[model samples]
Target: MEKKKVKNIFVEGPISAAFIGESIAKHSSNTNIGAHSIFLGQVRSDVLGENVVQSIEYTTYADMALEKMAEIREEIFAKHALTCMHIHHSLGIISAGEICLFVFTSSKRRRAAVDACTEVVERIKNELPVWGKEIFADKTHQWKENTL
Candidate 1:
């Protein structure tokens, strides 16, 4: 049996627009792909009492995260007719309004791509060992919790 290679999905700081554009552009030549679904997660400034969120510092257990991601990739591919899938998540400090997560999925049909993308995002949020520290404008911080 052939071993699957684990992909590194972590990107330092925030995800840039240019990087996302480049990633999309790279798939233009693949004629077999008929549909593409993309999801971008951004940091939002939420008011908690008197303090307002200014940024989020993200951290993860890299090795474990990658292992879990690889399993997810395999499962998603097995369940969906996906031609390609890409996931990128931010590490370090990401300011409000900055992109933190990017997920792209391509398939021969729209439904497969869309479903796979949504499932991958949900799994990442629910299963991954990534954590985020919400930093307030007043310099106070609190651990962030994942919400559906």
Candidate 2:
């Protein structure tokens, strides 16, 4: 089976919550997934003791994010029998506790879907072109770019 069918990537500023949901729901209905799991990653208000994340401004390094996402999707489908997968991440000015990323995974069984969902999110965080900056409520700011 072709694993590339479910791969999708988008770079946008302040993406809407509804849009992300719809993206996941757009998968082919003929695909019968007995279980579907979604993970919503919210931008927290604080990071380390010296830093505060009142908002997050995410930026990408061009098409790199999409390429990495496709790789991750292929890995997920190869490892698990997933019916579909969707990943959506916001690109700018995300407020505290607002979602920065959303991951949706489906499979014929609950166990595989749950496991692949976790793995996909971890891969995205460790390998995507996306970079984020944290702006404090007090107006101070710092880049939250990961070493990965």
Candidate 3:
């Protein structure tokens, strides 16, 4: 059997708006795709008792995460009639209001694209071995909990 190829989905820091716009622009040429669904995960400042979160430091086991993502990609493709799908996640410190995760899915129909995008985002959050440390304004930090 041939070895499976894994796609790298990790970005250095925050995902940029220009990059997102460019991604959408690039897909315009693909006439087969009738609909596109996009989900952008933004860092939010939350108050933890007396401390307020300033930023979040994201980290992941690259190899494991890639492997798991590949599995998710396969599953999503099998379940949805998708023309294309892309996922990008930040791997470093991301400030509040900055984009950290981007999930884009395209399909001939709107339902498939929307469903696939939502499923992929949910899987990535619950299944991937990625961790985030919430850094507070007072220099205190704590591990973030994954919530649906």
Candidate 4:
């Protein structure tokens, strides 16, 4: 099959697990993948010894986010011999402990798929311009960018 199965980029106003599953399924199909791996990122409570996180408000630098996601996808494709990959992240208010991002990858072998999936997720967190606000149980909040 052609290498076009790999998604160049995917941007959403609000992302979900179901949406990510479908996108990955479609991208991995008709390819020669022997294994598929997926990683789902959920916002969690607590930030540097603070109260429980009530919700997470995520924002982006608009065009920068798109550019960054595109770069991430391209880098993954360049470095991995994979069938396809898809990354989706939420764009609005997401409750704490709820999933906000997903990284899915497929390859001809299990090892490559797993490695590529891991790399893609790490890159997105490191390089994307997506900002998040952690809402505390007391109704206060603080902005945070992904570190490492």
Give all candidates' CA lDDT scores.
0.96, 0.77, 0.95, 0.75
Candidates arranged by lDDT, highest first: 1, 3, 2, 4
lDDT value for candidate 3?
0.95
Q: Tell me the lDDT of model 2 at 30.
A: 49
The residue pairs found clashing in candidate 2 are: none
lDDT per residue, candidate 1, 1-148, as tens digits?
5667899999999999999999999999999999999999999998999999999999999999999899999999999999999999999999999999999999998999999999999999999999999999879899999863
lDDT of 3 at 28: 83
TM-score of each: 0.96, 0.81, 0.97, 0.80
Estimate, for each residue in 1-148, the C-alpha lDDT of model 4 and write its tens digit.
Answer: 3333233343444466677667766764466778889888887876657577878888777677676676667777888888877667777778876778877788888998899998888878888777888888788888876684
Top-TM-score structure, candidate number: 3
Clashes of 4: 0
Question: Could you give the C-alpha RMSD of every candidate to the true structure, in order shown?
Answer: 1.6, 3.5, 1.4, 4.5
lDDT of 3 by residue, 39-143 (tens): 999999999899999999999989999998988899899999999999999999999999999999999999999999999999999999999999999888999
Prediction 2 TM-score vs. true: 0.81
Q: Is candidate 2 or candidate 3 better by TM-score?
A: 3
After superposition, candidate 4 runs with Cα above 4 Å error? 1-14, 24-31, 47-50
How many clashing residue pairs, candidate 1? 0
Error of 1 at 146 (Å): 1.7
| Ranking of predictions according to TM-score | 3, 1, 2, 4
